[model samples]
Target: MKKVLILSTALTSVAMAASAEEISVMSWGGAYATSQIEAYHKPFTAQTGVSVINVDADNPAAPIKAQVEAGNVTIDVVDLEYADAVRMCDEGLLEPIDPAILPAGADGTPAADDFLPGAVAECFVATIVFSTLYAFDESKFPENPPTTIADFFDTAKYPGKRGMRKGAKVNLEMALMADGVPAGEVYALLETPEGVDRAFAKLDTIKNDMIWWEAGAQPPQLLADGEVVMTTGYNGRFFAAAVAEGKPFKQVFDGQVYEYDGYAIPKGAPNMERAKEFIVFASQTQQLADQAKWIAYGPARKSSGPLVGLYQDGKTEMGPFMPTAAANLTNALPSSYEFWVDRDAELNERFNAWLAQ
Candidate 1:
């Protein structure tokens, strides 16, 4: 009896140790990360008995690439934009996620059939559809309020510094649209050298008045502190500040560029199985719907749409604020993943040289 008791105690300890395993996740931090924490991370941990260590990256793609190429992969999973996800997959920096393992939708539709068009990719499973939109402090723009993308570059009219991401992707697209290129023609024109120059020339107009931001959290802070009269940032970040924190920020949906942000495992993540498990758990229909309650981003799953309604506050409707809403899409542009996947390196190089000059 004494010998049996000792063996039982040892087995239980081993099981407890195995159950306490941890996985590191990297993402764009701020209310976005908070929404994932409340909707996906906490519930996943509670259900699986696995510990999640969350980390922030200005852009998870950059650090994830570095970590993978260095052969020192610490992050098990990362949330990345559609283009970055596709680019990374092409570079073989990420592990391929199998659609077979993903759960079916709440209404019994297959995973492949249920996700929004282009949401699921070879290397990543998309979680949310978000937009890069500019926001302003209402107090700063009361008289002649800035409304359009052209106004974002009109420093003489708005008369204050503007906050833009420290990257060439969305800015270039917005520049073209602001400079009178139709949203439909923006990418087609950008395929040429002269068109690239035109976009940069538009950007040059506001270069002196620009304050560059990397993290999603910085724009709201910059707006609230009166450091910038207008700033381009994720729509959800502005929503959190305006609705949750009761800040006076207002999003400029005109010329907003919408895209998907999703999950991908590093090529040689330490906790591959557990990371895959987390993805499966978080990508379920109900889980995706739950995320919208915390942030205004539209869930990637179509089945999750009807289920989405109120914000976590329980009174504010989240539909009209979503980037995919018909009202918001009238003047909006859909970000082209293929364009960025092929041109990201070259354009960013030119962008860097332009910055230096």
Candidate 2:
């Protein structure tokens, strides 16, 4: 068995060498991956002749930690949330990415200066500013659409199964917001035991009516298949389905929780050099801006903002749909990476136990 496995690996390696160098990048699949593929992978492959093999995970951060600890790292680069990036870097699970390797913005500003605040961390280079927002099928509530976070929890009025991600982070915050706690006070309130109870109690309101999802791709499909009427999902996925695929979806940006998602190399990735090259290439001004065309995620670089224009359909403007847009910011909450980094494990454990009950 060992011999056969070794021979298979050897033959695969030989084949790869004869064809092209390939780096595996694990990301949340669906429209998000498609955006990266169009904006980064194809262009990078064309420029360097190093093919990119895309991989998907429910959460890329988990597999990265497992692979590094097991001494069998295979993924060259992973897309991760800011908190996971910071946590893994602190735990020595990821490679330290030097900012010097990144290119200057289109306007000639240094990479460090050009990227938005907290966009670059010790182990990651933030690529996009995305949001976790709930959207409903237009067909679900035709007369009166869900316009606010509170409306999402009003199952009595709306009358349908709700979709939520199978995790604690966004759900807790949303629960607080839906319960009428101001966005500014969410994390502060969450710091107290009473506040935690309040959030959980609010979540209990829709617990029975909830359909939990793991992958970013699931929510759109859940909505499409009529499995759910309204679901919290990455804003980009909703944009792709509604705009690109012409599905009957509508984004409810009110009380949206936005965060940075970026690329990090696991400590011992086989193609370290290629991974670095890919990161630098993908983090460039044009590439980041180009990504916005395919999805609603905002580029992390300030220079890229001006470059973002129409969507892939070439008619719809992308600016108003972004989480960073002025109109969208009215009821938005920027996720605190520091808060999540500190409490992720304890909260997740509590969340799992709550789910089991």
Worst 10 residues of 2 by lDDT: 13-22
Q: Kindly provide the TM-score of model 1 when superposed on the true structure, using C-alpha atoms.
A: 0.94
Candidate 2 residue lDDT tens string, 23-63: 99999988999999999999999998899999999999988
Alpha carbon lDDT of residue 258, candidate 1? 97
TM-scores for all candidates: the values are 0.94, 0.94
Compute the lDDT for candidate 2: 0.95
Task: Show where candidate 1 strays beyond 4 Å.
Answer: 1-20
Model 1 worst lDDT window (10 residues): 15-24
lDDT of 1: 0.92
